[model samples]
Target: MFSKVLVANRGEIACRVIRTLHRMGITAVAIYSEADAGAKHVALADEALCVGPAAANKSYLNIEAVIEAASSTGAEAIHPGYGFLSENVEFARACTAAGITFIGPAEAALEIMGDKIRSKNHVAQAGVPLVEGISEPGLSDEQLISAGEKMTFPVLIKPSAGGGGKGMHVVERPEDLGETLATARRVAKASFGDDTLFIEQLIRSPRHIEVQVLADAQGNVIHLGERECSLQRRHQKVIEEAPSALLDEATRARIGQAACDTARSVDYLGAGTVEFLVSDEEPEKFYFMEMNTRLQVEHPVTEEVTGIDLVEQQIRIAAGQPLSLRQEDITLTGHSVEARIYAEDAEARFMPSAGTIIGLQEPTGEGIRVDSGMLPGLVIGTDYDPMLAKVIATGADRDQALSRLHQALGGTIIHGLTTNTAYLQQLVADEDVRRGQMDTTMIERKLPDLQFPTPQQHHAVAAGLLAAQLKGLHPETAGNQEEGPTGWQPDGWRHSGAQNPVFAVSWQPPGTTAEPQEFDVIVDGSSRLIPVGEGRYLLRSSATATEVHLTAGEGSRQTGTEIWISSGDFTGALSVLDQEAATHRQLAEIEAELTEALPEVTAPMPGTVVAVGVESGHEVNAGDVLVVIEAMKMEHRLAAPTAGTARINVALGDQVSLGQVLAAVEAEQAENTESKD
Candidate 1:
């Protein structure tokens, strides 16, 4: 066993690794970027080092920095947790040359399995079933176009390097293949530093199933049960579980063995995952997608079911230990599910959100486990992945697991920024998802039907009462204002005089584009914010009282003219639209034709411009993607909102902020009217 191991990564994975190392009595070393100096992972480690700047490439992905951090700390081994340098071939070789053990597969395994094209081909040569496609290396655009013409329509384009579904595109139309290829190549270069790509047959109604395999340097390889990762958006997994509901015992054994065989072909070491595209129509048939050379983000679910510590296995394997468990010894005890909670607003097209954490309440109980990266005062930014935590639950059956996960989600609360908590809760209860009748594109199809309602009347009542309590306006407060107008003042709120205070607010739920609906709650002293116990509150609605919050977020306004409220399963941003400065802004908008006059489309989140689809003065109609910006490893396209001559404001490689103007569409009528003027 390693006396000390340096974690060459940040966030929850690093913290998770440190916990295991502590459990095994191994000294843990952690490396962090400047942005993560105060991160939870750094605090959890025995020793820590600042690697580089906030940029991932400079810090977590910097091979030299990570290696030096390990060497200086006298670390015997380095653990690249899931992302950054986890599957990096050069990083592995660097560790070996430096006499520091890499707690993962060797260079051979990383080089072969890290590249999707090579892995697909290598596994195929080993008699592993391959998905039908043109996977020849270094295929040019013309070659892919030529191949597309001969093959069926709707082929999938995947970058040869990198995982987590980045740079993967599905070209549905024959005409769009050329343009789509260019975008994919660009993303591939920017993300993986590899522009090489391959085409694959787009399997419809396919279920994503993957088997977790553990191996050692002695060529002993054993497989754990499979995980279902079909709940996805833009090919990025949102929910994952072990012991796939879609697979039968017979198919499960076959897939598990295939995974073991795939590992054996490369003489794989440590923990690796073999992904397969299983057909929903025929569960028996499965095709190899690609192998993840390092630990997977969804690995916790597998550990829960098999009662095996994969990270421990990786450490042991890297130390040249033989496999501890045989294939027969691995028995999945129960069903486990994991939901990835991201710093994103689910109502706002799932846009990446950034803010300082003012409050937080993670779920905990008999069957629930939370792998969290966030802490109170932790600032979430767009520099790294937006995933803040993962909530996993286990039970005797899938239904129980889903139910526990759902309840756990309702109990979760994070303040100061929006998250996808409510969205995940609704997903677990989805009919299609509950019945195991789902596919890769299930999220997109069912997203429209998922109800992420805006702040209801009860939510307004809760916020109103909470505000009164904080302002000493609640009857429970000992302040003496017997009658007449009283002054109410809260954080970032101006003093307001009223006999009966009225809070005029507008709330926008995540995942919805609808304009904030204005809601007014009158605090006539009938309503009072009272603690019912366990961080929960009760809001009075006339004669009736509604219990709100299993946990609460920043229930009051602070920096911005908005109050974030967590009610039941939902957390919403309530803008103080009718307050002091807000009133003046609304009046100004009405005086000028501001709502209709605004022609510029701005970025919803901060990021670098990746693509410019239109040049200045180019004619475009509504809904044409004019600019693509990459933030938090996700690309968002800014579109022309009206028919006009497009006037782009920002260029490729420009860093933009939230609401920064990207482009302006000069309507023909507006141009004509201006000319006449």
Candidate 2:
């Protein structure tokens, strides 16, 4: 085994790799950009180095810097975790040239499969079932159009490079083809630096299934079953599970063999995934999508179900050893499901949320696994992916696993930053998801009803109110309440007895533009309070206090109330903003102002503009890649649309402000464009 390994990546994946290395008694070296200096992965590594500035172009993507860091640290191998240099063929070759092992597939394999068109062709030649499309290279736009005509309307324009939905566009008709092509080309050039693209027939409502395979240098290979990754948003997976519920034993075996065939055809090494598009409309029909020649982000579900440490296996194989376990040794013990918890607001368009995490509660039980990068004090920054953690649950069967997942989500609590926690809870219990009838279009189909949180919102409001009340009674405020300028507190002197002080406070629930809920709180100056809102407030003083005295307000309801507290240590109540509002108060007010002021342009996520497609005064349509933001060695283009607008913003080479206005697009009408990246 290697004594030390350099992890050439950042965020949760880096932290995840280092954890496995530590368990295997190997020193882990972490590389970070300026923005990642204080990141979770950096603090977790045994050795750390700053490669360059915040921008990934000058840091994470800097091949020379990474190599030097590895050499200086005397690392015997470099583990390019997922994104960044994970799939970069040149980086793999560089490591080999430097006599350092790369813990992934060989550079030759990457060179062939990294290009989408070539990879598809290779798989097709191996007799794998491929979807109807052109996998050949060197096709002109006119030729592409001809191929599209053959495929008919609703064709998929995919970049013949990288994955993760980047540079992929879906055109429903001919009139949208040109713009989609231009956008795809620009995105392809930015993301992969290869403007090459291919056309495919769109598989409506397809379940994105993938087979996990591992191979050693000696050509010994085995398949570890399949993972269903149909629950997605913005082309990125949100939820994943192992032993796809939709596939039968025969179909599963066939898919597994096809995956092995594809791996052997490419001389694949280490752990990789062969993705397939399984149609929801047809149970037995599955088509080859592409092969990811590195560890997948949703690998935990596979690990949980198979009892395998994929990272440890990667290292063992890279050391020129065979896979530790044979196909027969692999067994699917139970059902497992994982949800990718992101720091984004699910109700408010899933906007990436950045803020300090005031409190955190991770679920722990018989079958729960939480792979996280966040703690109580960690601050989520916009310079990286908005993902906070991957919450996994396992059980003896599918229904049990789903039940456990729902419980885990409920037990898990996060404060400070907005999250998709409420949405996740709903998704697990959702009829389609629970029935295992999930597909990529599942979320979209249930979007209208799933767009808001009702019960969770009620609980959140109750928690917020409780938190506000708790803050009001804090020692600091309790000691100096009468001296405040607002004169909001009652005038009082020293009280000798245990007195319950009542105060009236009002708050508007989230998403409600008008009318704030008014409540009266009676504090006994102890640890708890009785809150009365639109319902009667009850106080429990004994174990059998069901019929305790109830104080009712006008229009009070018979339903009892639940509360939430903001403090991480506190249980049963939500955390409400404790600090009194200054001239401006309430989260809604702050959000409203931010929306009115901030521009619509997609901001950079710790990346550089590799290419600028437009200039001042250029009229651009929606979904146009105005500027490409490259980060962690990967490039992402910021596009326009959802409305069309003329450029009235700054020029290229300008160090743009965070959330600055790049251009203005006055929406001709409100419309939703599904994300391509």
Best by lDDT: 1
- Which residue runs of candidate 2 sit more than 4 Å off their true CA positions? 140-143, 454-647, 652-677
Task: Please count the clashing residue pairs in each candidate, in the order shown.
Answer: 6, 14
Index of the highest-TM-score prediction:
1
Candidate 2 lDDT over residue span 1-677, tens digit each? 89999999987789899999999999999999987777888999999999999656688888999999999999999999886788989998899899999999998789888888888887777777888887679888877877677676778888887676665777999777876787678667755668899988877789999999999999988999999999987567888998899999898888888889889988899999999999887868889899999999889989999989999999999998887688889889899999989877666566566666665767899899988877767767655667788889999998899899988887677766567877888889898888898788778677677644332332333333343354454322443455344334532333342223443334333322456445444344333234443222332332321111111111111112223232221222222322233212455567777775423665533334556767655667767767765443334467775445555465554555445566666555556888888
Alpha-carbon TM-score of each model against the true structure: 0.93, 0.79
lDDT of 1 at 635: 84
Whole-model lDDT, model 2: 0.72
Worst 10 residues of 1 by lDDT: 551-560
Model 1 misplacement above 4 A: 476-498, 509-513, 532-535, 550-561, 577-582, 591-598, 670-677
Model 1 TM-score (2 dp): 0.93
